[model samples]
Every structure is written in C-alpha cells, then in structure tokens.
Target chain A: MSGREAILGNIRKGLKRSGPLAGTALELCQTRLREHRPNLIPARAQLPHAGQVELFVQMAQEASATVARVTERAAVPAEVARYLADIGFAAEAIVAPDASIAGLDWSAAGVATEARHARNGDRATVAPAFAGIAETGTLMLLAGPQSPTTLNFLPDAHIVVLDAARIVGPYEDAWAMLRSERGEGWMPRVVNWITGPSRSADIEQKLQMGAHGPIRLHIVLIGD
Target chain B: MQITSPRFKQNAHEALGDAALQRALGNLKAGFPGKRAAAVARMPEFEQLRDAARDLKNHILEHLDFYLETFEANVKRRGGHVHWARDAEEARAIVLDICRKAGAKTVTKGKSMITEEIGLNDHLAANGIEPIETDLGEYIIQLRGEHPSHIIAPAIHVNLDQVSDAFHAHHGKYGKTERQTEPRALMNEAREILRDKFIAADVGITGANFCIAETGTTVIVTNEGNGDLTQTLPRVHVAVTSIEKVVPTLEDATLLHRLLSRSATGQEIEVYGTWSSGPRRPEDPDGPAEYHVVLLDNGRSNMLGNEFREMLRCIRCSACMNHCPVYGAIGGHAYGWVYPGPMGSVLTPAFIGVEQAGNLPNASTFCGRCESVCPVRIPLPKLMRHWRAREFEKHLTPQGFRFGLGVWAWLARRPKLYRLATQVATRVLKPLGGKTNRIGSLPLAGGWTAWRDLPAPQGRTFFEQWKDRQQAGGAK
Candidate 1:
C-alpha cells in the first residue's frame, strides 16, 4: 500500500473506524467544512467602524508600529515622505506594483519610488494592505501580482497604507471578506497577518527588533 | 537525538549543579510565564477559547483520515505535493528525495521540531546538502552542534558568553573576528550572514502550526520573519509537519492561533502569521516555484487511540515548560531529547519506549501547573501517572524503588498499624528537633535532607490529635 493509505489506515484503526465516514458522518464533515463557521469571536472585536479604526491604531502603536492618519489617498505619498524624513532616511522606497500604489504620484511629494518586489539592501517598501484588523491591530496582506510577498519581509522599513474603510473589527471578518472576494475554497498563495516589526528574544530572553524583517513599521492610515 | 532519557535522574542531578545552565534557567523562569499570565488576564474569553480549541482538536482527531485526505487534495488543487511518512526514516528519506529532485546544494530551514524528530539535517548533510537554521535560537544551538533544549527557545541552555564564544570562533570566515556581546549587534551579524543564504538556498523547509483542510493551506506563526523568507525566497518549499496538525478550516486554525502566541510568549499575536497555499502563481513576482508538504505520523497515530490522545492537542506553546517548577529548576537538557517539561515527560515515553524513558514521567512533582496553564488542557499529570503504571507493570523501575513501594503499600493497607507506627516514629524523632523544630539531617533520608533541612515531626501523630479533639467535642 502507498504511504498515504497506510498512515490513514493506522489513523482509522486508532479512531476505531474501519473505513471512511458514511451517511450522517460524511455529510456532517462536508457541511462543517463548507460552512467554516468561527468558534467564538472575542467581545473586544465587536466594535463599530470608527471604534475599530481607533482600536486598530491603538493596538498597532502598542505593538511598536508608528501610525499616521491621512485624509485622502492622494495624501499617502506626502505622509510616507514625512515619515522617512522624520526617521532620517532617504525619501525613496520600493513600492508594490498594486494599482493603488502605482498610480500614486510619489515624486509630487518629493519621494522617489521603484514599484516592484523588494530586493536585498532595500531600505523600505510601501504596499497596500488588503485589510486592517482591529482586534490585534494586524495588517492582512494577500500575495499576488499587485502585492508581492517579498516586499513585506525583505526590507528594513515597511510602510503600509490601508484605507480606514477597509479596516475590520475581527480576523474572521477579514477572512470572510477574502472568501467572498475570491470564491470559497480559493486562497491566495500567501496570506500575511503582520502585527508589527519583526522581533526575537532568543538572546538572553531580551527582545530586539528587526529580526530578519522591517526594523520600523510605518502605517499610513488613509482616513480620519 | 539519542535517547539519553534512561539517565534522566543523573542528567537532572548534574543540571542542578551546572552554574551556567542555572543562570540561564533563572532568566527563563522570569520571562515567559509572567507574560502569559498578563496576556490571559487581558482576554476575558481566553478560557472559553481554550475549551473551544481542545474540542476542535478532538473533533479533528476522530475524523483524522477525512481531514488529512481533504488537506492533501486541497494542496494538489493549489499545485502543491503532499508526501506521507509513516515513521522517522521514511520522513527523512522523503525530504532528502525532494532535495535531490530539486538539485538543492544548500537548504535554509525555519525552526521545526518535526525535522529534529526525524533528524533531517544530519540526513541531508550526509547526502552533501547543507541545512542552515534561520531562527536565532535554533541557529545558536546548531552552531554548537546541539539539539534544541527547549522547543520555542532552543538555546535556552546557552548563556550570553557562550554565544559570544561560538560566534567569535566561527565568524572569521565572514570577516567578523571581534566578539559581539550586545544582543542587537550579534543579531545583526546573524541577519547579514543568513541574508545571503536565504537569497541563495535551493530549498526551504519549515514546520506548520496548522494545515487548513478547507483551502489546503499551511500556516506558520513566527515572531521572526525568517519562516516567511525560508518559504518565499527558495526555489522549492517543503513544510514538514505531523498528521495531527491538520485542522478542518482556516477559522478553526485562527481560533487556535489566538491562543498559541499568548500561551507561548505572552504576545497578543506573533508578529508574522503567514499562510502558504502552494507554489507561487504565474502572476506572482517572487516566491517558491514548487511547494511540498511532508506529513509524518511517527507515533502520533498510535497516540490517537491510547490514553495519551490528548497530547496531540499540544501546540508547542512552551507554556507547560515555562510554568513547570521542575523544568525551571533543571532546565530542558536534563530531559535529554528534542522535547522537555510536562509535555515532554508524557511524549518522550510514547515516542521512545516506556522502558527507555521510564525515568521521565517520574521526574514530575505532580504540581498540576502545566495542565492549569495548558491552552488545550492536556491532562499531562494523568498521562505521566499512566506511564508510571506501565513502567511498574513492565518491571522497568529499579528494584529498590519497587521494594520501597511494596513496603509502603503494605503499611498503608492497615490503618491501625499505620497510625501506631507513625506515632511511635514521631515520638522517637521528637528530641532530634533543634530549637527551630527542624531536623538538620537523618540517617535513612539523607537524600531528602542533602539540599535543605527537613521539617521535624511534632510529638503526636494526626490520628491521636484527631481523637483527642473528638473527645473534647470539637466544633467539627
């Protein structure tokens, strides 16, 4: 027998099922998979939209990411430039190829941009988040042509822009939105939920930031 | 990877006397447990979530075959390969076979306990492939040619000066001759050195916290972004995880994800939680060209049917170890395997034989703190007792221990005789108590009195005191 069948056979024997589930058991399994219902949503995640954005900012800041609110999409370039200047960095960043980011006139705000995946020694990468989660102040970025996975991890500074309208109160809401956008059972190659800059406490249990990812995480919130 | 668990008592005895390990363990006791307590305090629904997490795993275990099959089919749909290994040897062969097919020269690895369980790196190196551990903790231990002492913190046994010595000795090739004592400077050195390997490695291997059956996705939660780079930067990505890691859906994976980091390191969430479905899509700019999942079932399938079935619910959170008083005292190396602490005590006996690891379950104090802090509520103490029973039945325990147990059982059988003996003993030993009412040492119980003074017994036994109180018409 194949290794797959042999292992499954042992599992079946262990669970006391001679074979696969049938009738009600099979139906119940299928229904549960299809439904994909969440177990229990934390009450802290059940907030209004404005409240969620507020909580998102608060939590993101707590996780050591700097948050800046911009009134409109056109204001993102200026905000990015300002953050770079404040950090004493160059005003050039590797921007994601996402249309929302590509269409922005970065030079108008005195910032130079290379719209592609990040490479070694890249100082920063500005990308658009699919959604901002309020519960943990996390940014959900799906991998695709517009959003390259490398742009998130290969740079020292990660500058993310998320529309306030795209913020959700819980992770389940973000996942549900993804299922609805890309049909059920269809998942992106990668779904990244980034809470803050990378960190590790491996050295004497003392945490140090920028452990193989962005040292500074700058979130440009595109609304009040 | 050798089962030194047979010498657990000796190893623990030596660990208690090692000053460097003691200092490191001192830092560990103050780190993770306090953070977990604070994290739990903030989340009012944390207990409910743990119950839900445990039930979710139980449901999956009952329907393990269906969920695993579904997971495989989903991975195939996403253009990824799923390989099953019945044991450690097969798991190693399967991984090496994939590396050979990929023509891999050097492989960069994310921290994976399963690979350590299968001894994958040694297998790959024997076949002329270099495996680089990317996690800071795993990397330090790897440099010392050591296995992980702790699951989450692999180098928890190594101190700062030791890291400095290792780096100073090995980093000359990379033009770093001076020893870096500061954690930040040392971390940056590793980052620079590993950056080249991540960019150049042919295959990247990682462990999965959860394998979602609904979408055929494998989720890896890491505070360091190294797991992401390990999977994304290589030409081939292989996720090595066990059979029990498969969950029914992403929602279920998220529910457990909420509990894992909080329990492991007291973070609300790990900095990076990445879900990889398959290889990169044609439209993607950068990611692995091929994706694979190596699913192993070394002894966990057997655990599903036995009294230790609850052990499969473990998320490798390290909470059980951090809160374990025994683990705090001796550190992880005393357990002498890939795993340690309460979870390791139960798992080591099952992974190896009860005979080889008979001393592990005996190492516990039955403090019940591990189970109390366990997010999945594994009943670790009960499982250890089960192992102790099996050891006694198999005659694996020492002759002296068995004889002592027999005499104690005989004495316990007769209540009157037990009371009489205890009263006589207390009266005989009463004068030995000094001004402090504590015995400095005793002839037969030297082992107990070696480290600290033993509290002296009062003149009367509890039975006599209870009878006197009853005669005087006590409140009870």
Candidate 2:
C-alpha cells in the first residue's frame, strides 16, 4: 500500500472507525465544507458601507500604509504620479495587465509604465486589487494573467488601485465575494491578503520595514 | 536534531550561565506577553473567538481523514501533487526526490519548523544540495550553524553584537565587511544578501500555517514576506506540513487567523497572509511551475486516539511559551529540540519517547498562564500533568520523589494523623524561624532554599481555624 493508505489506516484505527467510513460520516464532513459557515465576526466589521470605508482608511494608516482618495477611475494615474513624486521616486512603475487598469493613460499623467510581471529590480509596482477588506485594512489580490502575484511582493513599493465600491467588511465577505466572482470551489493560483508594507521584528524584536517585500504600501481608493 | 531533552537539567544549567542568552531572554520575557495582553484587552470578543477556534479545530480533528482525502483530491484537481509520509525519514526522502527530479542545486527556505523537525536541511546538504534560509532570523542561525532558540523568532537567543559578528564573518566574501550594530542595518544587510539567493534558487520550501481542505490552499503567515518571495521566485515550491495543520474550510482558517496574530504578536493582522493553492496556473504570469505538499505524520497519528489529542489544536501562536515562567528563565534551546516552551514540553515527550523527554514535563510549575493565553485553549497544564502522571506510573520519576509522595499520601488517609503531623511541624518551624520568621535551610528542601528563604508557617492550620470559626458562630 502507498504511504497515504498507511497513514489513513493508522488514523482510522486510532480514531476507532474500524470499517470504511460510512456514508453518513462522509456526508457530514462534506456538508461542513460545503456550507462553510463563519463564526463570531467582530462587531467592528459589521459596520455600514461608509463606516467600512472610513475604517479601511483608518486601519490602513494604522498599519503604516499611505492612502489616497480619487473621485473617479480617470484620476488613478494622476494619484499614482503624485504618490511617486511625493516619495521622491522616479515617475515609472510596472503595472498589472488587468482590464480595469489597462485603459489608463500613463503618459497623459506623465508617468512611464510597463505592463508586465514585476521584475526583481523593479522599484515600484501598481496593480488593481480584487477587493479591500475593511476589518483589518487588507488588500486582496488574486494571482492570474491579469494581476501576477509577483507585483505584490517583489517591488520595494506596492501601489494598489482599489475600487472603493468593492471594499468589504470581514474576511468572510471577501471570501464570499471571491466565490461569487470566481465560482464556488475555485481560486486562482494564489490570493494575497496584504495588510501593509512588509516588516520584520526578528532582530531583538525591533520593528523594521522592507524586510523582504515592499517597504511602502500605497493604496488609491477610487470612488464609483 | 538529536534529542537533548533527556539532558534538560544540564542544558538549562548551561543556558542560565550564558550571559548573552540571559540578556536576550530578558527581552523575550518583556516582549511577547505584554503585547498579547494589550491586544487581548483591545478586543472584547477575543475570548469568544478563542472558543470558536478551539471548537472548530476539535470538529476538524475528528474528521481529519476525510478532510485530508478531500484536500488531496482538490490539490490534484489544481495540478498539484500531495505526498504522504508516515514518518520523518519518509518525509525527508519525499522532499529530496522532488528536488532531485527538478535537478535543483540550491533551494531557498522560508522559516519552517516542519523542515527542522524532519532534518530537511542537513539531509539536503548531505545530498549535495545547498539550502539558503531566507528569513532573517533563520539566516542568522544558519550562519552560526545553530538551531532556532525560539520558534517564531529563530534568533531570539542571539544578541545584536553576535548578529553583527556573524554577518561580518560570513559576508566578508561578498565584499561587505563593515560591522553594523543597528538592527535596521543588520536587516538591510541580510536582505541584500538573500535577494540574490531568492532569484538564483531553483526550489523553494516553506511550511504551511494552515491548509484549507475546501480549496486545496496552503496558507503561510509571515511578517517579513520571505515565504512569499521564496515561493514566488523559485521554479518549484514545496510546502511541508504535518497532518494536523489541515482545517476543513476557509471560514475555519479565518477564525483561527483572527486569534493567531493577536496571540502571537500584537498585530491585528500580520503583514502578509498569502494563500497558495497550486503551481502557477495556465494563465498566470508568475509563480512556481511545480507545487508539492508533503504531509508528515511521524507520531501525530498516535497522538490522535489518546488523551494528548487536544495538542493538535495548537495554532502555534507561541503565547503559551511567552507566558511561561520556566521558558522565560531558561529560553528555548534549553528544551533541546526543534520546539521549545510549554507546547514543546508536552509534545517533545510524545514525539521522542517519554523516557527521553520526561524531564520536559517536569520543568513546568503548572502556573496555567499558558492555558489562559492559549488562543485555542489547549489546557497545557492539564496535559503536562498527564505526562507527570505517566512518568510516575512508569517509575520514571526519581525514587526519592516517589517515596516522598508516598509518605504524604500515607499521612493524608487519616485526618487526625495528618492534622497532628502538620501541627507539630508548624510549631517546630516557628521556633526555628526566630525573629526573621523564615527557614534558612532544611533537609530534602535544598532546591527551594538554594534560591531564596522560605517564609515561616506561623499561623494555625486551616482545620484549626475552621473549627474555631465554627465554634465562634455557634456562640453568636
């Protein structure tokens, strides 16, 4: 028998389920996974939409991320340019090829943009987030052809364009949104829930930013 | 990797004497607990969340076989492979096979306790494959050829000067020989050095914090994002986790995630909570081309059918150890294994035989602080007591202790005899105590007296006080 069979057999013997798993037991297991009910969401996460957006911005700042608000999608490039200049960075960055972000005119905003996966030497990366979670100020990015996962981690600065309308309260809501959009029982190769810029407290338990991922996380919230 | 748990006393003695380790340990004592306390005080529903997390884990462990099968099938559906290993040797061999198939000369590693448990690095090095540890703490320990003193903070036992010296000694060949004392400078130096390794590595290995059975997703929580970089840059990705790490659904992972960060660190959420389901998809622009997960059983299967089964509920928050007085005194290395502190004390005896690690369970004072702060409420003190009971039953405890307990038990059977024994001892001790009202030293109590004087028992026994209260009530 394979190692899988042996380990499973050991588990069965130990748990005292001597026979093959009966249909009822299997059904209960499947039902639990299928229903996937969330338990005890914090009261703070159950706020109204406006309250959520406010909390998202507040919590994001508390997590050490800078936030900018744009009244329209057309203003994203300008906001991006302003942020780059504010940080004294060159007006150039790699952007994800998501359709939501693909139509923006980078040159019109006076910023040079490369639409591809993030390269190791890339200093800044701009991608469109799948959703923004308000409960903890986390940005949810799914990995696929549209938004490569490397853009979230490889660059020193991560700039995300999140549609303010897509912001949700709890992580469960984000997962629910994921299922509704991508279909149940399906996910991309990866889903990154980035709360803030990378940090490390490994040395003497001192907080240091830019340990391995982006040092700065800048989010541009675009209103509907 | 060798079990020095049998020599816990000797290890703790050495650890206590090391001035550098003592200084580092002082920071650990002051660091994690207060942060956790503050985080808990901020969240009103934190206790409710702990209960929810514990119940979910208990439900999952009961149906783990079914969940594992479902997780395996889902992984296969996503074009990933799941390998099961009954023991550490098999697990190590499985990982090596993957590396060999990819013709990997070098592998970058995220911080993984499972890899350390299975001795994966040494095994890979023995097979001529160099493993680069990318996590800053793990990297420092790697340079010094030492094991992690603390699980989360691998270099928790090493002071800053030691880190600077290690970097200076090792990074000289990279043409950077300057000695830096600031933590930020050290972090930057390590980042610069590991950045090249991340790009050059052919394979990346990480440990899963939780595996979602519903989606075949492996979750890794890291503040440094080394795990993300390690898995993202390499062509092949492997997640080595034990069978117990699997949870039934994303909701379960969410609930545990809420409790884990608060208990482990003060963060409401860690910086990077990345979920990788499989290899890079067909339409994915970047990610590993191959993904594998090795599910290790070792002795966890045995732990499932017994009293110690609740240990599997651990989310590895390190809250228990952070609150443990014994751990704060001796640090992690003194426990002498891959794991340390209260959780390790209970688990070490289970993994290695009780005979080898019996001393670990005895090291506790049963303060219950570990259980109080445990995110999943694992009842750590109760489990340690179980180990102590088993040791006593098997005659593994010292004969003197057994005889002492036996004498106490004999006297306790008769209430009159017990009361007389205690009353006579109290009277004899009062005169000995004198004006200081403390015992300087006594036979068979050197352990307590050596540290400090014991306060004299000047008052009447509880039975006498209770009787007097009853008579006074009757008079009233």
Candidate 3:
C-alpha cells in the first residue's frame, strides 16, 4: 500500500481502540466550537498607515528612541556602512544575513556581515522586510531568494531596512499574496513573520525585551 | 522518566521554597494571561474567530481519516516521506532507523512534545546519535537534566542566575571563555554556541503546530526562528507530530492560527509561522534535500472514542494552565509529565494508568477556572470529577476515607437525626470555643483544624430556624 494508505489504516485502528465515548467526545468538541469563540486581532488594523508611520517616528523621537532611515535604491553596502557608523557598531561585531540581501559590497561596507549565518558577535547584516506593522510594529520577512532567516535573530541590536511600498494590510493578506505568488506545488519551508524584538516576561513579570532574540529593533523604512 | 503523582506535591513544595522559581513563576503569572487579555480586548471579532477555529477543529476531527489521507498524498506528491507510528515504540524506532540510514551524527531539534512522549532523544542517545535541543528554553532544561516544566515555556521554573550558572558550567566545557551574568550576554553565548550545531547538524527535527490536509503542509510557529533554521539548513528535515494536528484546509488552519497566537502569547501572530510541504524541488536554491513526517498515535487514537476526546482539540496555547490557580501556585514541573496543568491532570491518567494518577484529578479545587479559560472549553473540572468517580469505582480510595464518606452520606440522608446530632454536638463543643470564637481542635476533624480554626456554629440549625419562623406565622 501507499504511504497514505498506511497512515489512514493506523488512524482507523486508533479511533476504533479509543472506544465508546469517542463519539460523544467528538460531539462535545462540536459544542465547544459553537460556544467559546476566542478573539482575534485583524491583520489590516495591525499595519500602520503612511500618516501613522510618520507619527510613530515622531513619537519614537520624542521618547528618545534611536531611529534611523535609509532609501531603498541607495547602494546597500554604503547604506549599511552609514548605519553601522551612526549606531557605533564595531566593524568586528558578528553579523546576521537574510537571503534576499544580494549584490552588496560586503568588504566595502567595512562591517563583517556574514551571509545566512547566525553568530554571537555584535555586528550583523540582514535584509529588511518591505513593511512594518504599526499595530504590533512587527517586521514580516518572506523566506525566499532575497531574505535569509538568520539575520532577523542572533544579534544584540537588529537593523532592518524595508521598502515602504511593499507593506500590506494584514498577516492573512501576506499569506494570500504568498500563496498567489508561489502557487500550489512549491512552498518555502520557512516564512518568518517577526514582531518587535525577542522578549520574555520570565523574570518576575518584568517585561524584559530581547530575552533570547534581538534586544534592539532598528527599522529603516525606505520611501519611494 | 518515571514521574509519580506524589512527586507533584514534593516538587511543588521545593519550587515554592525556591526564591528563583517563585520569581520566574511570578513573571509568567503576570505576563502571559495579561497580554492575552489585552490582545483579545483589542479585537471585537476575537470571539468570533475562536468559535470559527473551534468549529473547524471539530469538523476536521469528525473526518480526520479523510484529511489525513489527503495530507499524506499531498506530502508524497511534494517529494516528502510519511511514516505511520501506531504507538510510542514504533515512533521511536522509525526515527532511529531514519537517523541510522542517514548516518546522522547529530540532530538539532525544535521543541516537540511528541518527541518527548516517545522518548526520541533518549532513543537517539542510546543509539549513539546526539540530539540537540535548539530552543533556548529547551536547551536550558536539557542542560539542567530536567524535563520541561511548562508546555510553551519549558524553563518557566528557572531563574536568570540559575540559567547563568547552567551556562557557565556547560559552555565552559564546550570552549566558552567567559562566565556571564547578564541576560544579553548569556543569550549571545548560547546563540554563538548553538550556531555551529545548526550549521553542522545532519538532521533537523521539529514539531508541527498545524498540519493542513489541502496543501499537505506542516506549519510550525516559533518566536526565535530556531525551528525555521532547523527545518531549512539540515540535509534532512523530520517532522514528528500527533495525528490530531491535522486540519482540513488552509482556511481551517488560518482560523486556528488566529486563536493560537492570541491564546499563546497575546500576539496577533508569533514571529515566525513556517510551512514546510516537502523537500526542495529542482528550482529551489535552499532547503532540506529530504523531508519526512512521522504521524504518531501514541494513545491519542484511543482518546477519539473516549469522553476525553475533547482533549484532542487542544491547540497547546496553554491558556487553561496560564489561568488555573492550582497550576499557577504549583507550576508545571509539579505536574511531573510532558503535559501539565489542567490538560495534564486529565491526560496523564489516560496515558499512564488511572490508578497511578489518582492524586492528579483530586489536585484541583474545582474552581471551574480551567473550563472558563479553555479556548476550546474542555470542561476540565467535570473531567476531573469523572476521573474521581472512576477512582471510586476501582476502590482506589483509602479504607478510612471510604468509611468516613459512607457515614457522612448516611447522616446527610436523614435531616432530623443529623440536625439533633449536630445541635447536641454544638452545645457540648461551645465551652471549647476560644476568644476567637473558633474551635481550635476536634477529634475527628484534625485535618480541617490543623492549618485553620473551625468557626463555632450558631445554637440553631437552618431547619430549626425555619420551623420557628413557621410556628410564629401560624400563631399570628
């Protein structure tokens, strides 16, 4: 028999063995579905509008949060160099890379940026996502030719550059767009949708951001 | 590991006494449920989405076989292998054989409860294959030689100082030059140390959040992106998931996804929602060369026909645990199993013997909080009652407790006699009442009075008061 047939056979045997209450249990499952509905935040509201992004930047500035901006078409190498210089990230700090970041002058950038690598050092290079969700202020990165998964994590301060035009309304829209783009047969093994930095409330309920993930999230939204 | 029900009380006592554990548990108590509430409040349609998700799960469970078949076919069409394991032994054997065939020296794993259930790491280790847990929480627990304390937050019982010590002790042996106390420094140390393992590991293993039947995809949601790396970089990717994880279509999966993140960490979604269908095709530039999915039954199939089948609807968001007062006080490790909290209390007996887990069901205060907070509304307190009934049927209750309950039931059945006896007893005990108007001790009620005093009863019982009111009305 085919592998599918084997798996089904196993499932059938399991159901049969689970005994009499299985039917009632399943019915109860249906009842629960009818009863307790959990709330879900819509994806559209999660994204910040163009006006909201401006206000957000202003708010960040007012709050004394370090903010940086980079233009999309500018040479990535030079832009990365300027970003590092401004942030005072040493040239020798470890770097992370997203696969989408291509044709960059790594040596000229003067920072040791590893491609598709997760290292412990302070410096890293990553491909910025297209848009940041204003509601959660999340950076969504599709794992494809241009973006690598490593750069989003494995750094103290994460610097991401985004193409403002590529922003979408919600996570579902991104998924729908991804399905349309990739089609039925081929799906990327990993699509990382990141929000803010790594955080944990594991210590006395204190909101300690960046527990095991990036401590600082720097987004460079490139205007058209 | 042999985890006993008695160990729960012991472990809880030890945990309560430890300042570090108390600190860690305090963080979880304040953070997870609070975030979930805020996230829920933000969305007007959150309840609707949860209902849809729950309905979708129920529908899928009804035709689980059909969906599993579709999923398996899709996976094969995409060049992935699917293995069927009827029980834990079969599951472990299948994984070990795969490792042996691949000549794998090292395996990097994402957090998989199924793997824990089947003892995959132990199996691999016994066979001389090193299985490395890459999730920081899992890694910490592994280094400390302990099981996961909580389902989602594995190292919930561990504090930063303990983590620092674990890192200092372990990383030093692995060539780490520094002992760091700060959280950032420790995280960096782990990242640096694990990076090489990720790059060099021959196989990657992960647990599935949801398995879609329509597209034949297994989805994993994670915050750290470790699961993504584990699935992508390795030459071989193996997914170990329970059979109940299957959903009919991407739409159904999406419905569940809406509830999963909100219930889990109060986020709209986790940092990463990865879908891996199969191995890489010719056009793909990067991915695992081979993909395999092991669908494990391991006593879940039996649950399908049982009253406890609703347990299968668990999305593992841990909402019930987050809200349970008993779970909150004792924490996950005290439950002493792969699953913990209300879910574990119901599940452990089913997986192991009911006789061995008698204490688990009785552990609850029956506050009904678990049932209320459950995203799927499992009615956990009722399930515990069912277990208690079963325990009684099996004559598992102690002889003395049984006799006490029998005498109490007899007295409760005859109101007049019970009232007279109570009245006489109250008059005799009135002299013993202290200045606090409390009885400090009683012969048969030492258990109640040991930790607290019993309030002195009023002279008249409810029945006597009611009779007096009736006589006055008649006379008037």
The 0-to-1 C-alpha lDDT of every candidate, in the order given, reads 0.93, 0.91, 0.72
DockQ of each: 0.89, 0.85, 0.26
RMSD of each: 1.4, 1.2, 5.5
Which lDDT value does model 1 have at B193?
A: 95
Model 2, residue A157: what's the lDDT?
Answer: 92
Clashing pairs in 2: none
lDDT of 3 at A1: 73
State the iRMSD of every prediction, in order shown. 0.7, 0.9, 5.5
Candidate 2 TM-score versus the reference? 0.98
* Candidate 2 local lDDT, B1-476, one digit each (tens): 77799899999989889999899998888888889888888789999998998899898888889889888999999999999999889999999999999999999999999999999999999999999999989999999999998888899998889999999999999888889899999998888889999999999999999998999999999999999999999999999999999999988899999998999987899999999998987777889999999999999988889899999999888989888999998999999888899999989988887899999999988989999999998999899999999999899989889999999999999889999999988887777777999988977799889778988888678888899999999998
B10-115, model 1: which lDDT tens digit per residue? 9999999999999999889999999999999999999999999999998998898999999999999989999999999999999999999999999999999999
TM-score of each: 0.98, 0.98, 0.83
Instruction: Report the C-alpha lDDT of model 3 over B1-476, residue by residue, as the tens digit.
Output: 65756566677677678776777778788778888998788667776776766666676666677667668888988889989887788899999988888889999999888898888898899999999998888898899998887888888888888888889889887888577887757766777788778888999999998987766889998876678768877889999998899976555676777678888778766766677778876645567889999998777766776777777888888888888888888788777777888888998888876787877888888998777767666778888888888888899988988999899899999988898888897777776776767898988899779757888876666777898999999999
User: Tens digits of per-residue lDDT for model 1 on A1-224?
Assistant: 98888898888899898898788999999999999998899999999899999999999999999999989999999999999999989999999998899889998999999989989889989999999999999999999989998999999899999999999998999999998998877788999999999999998999999999888899999985
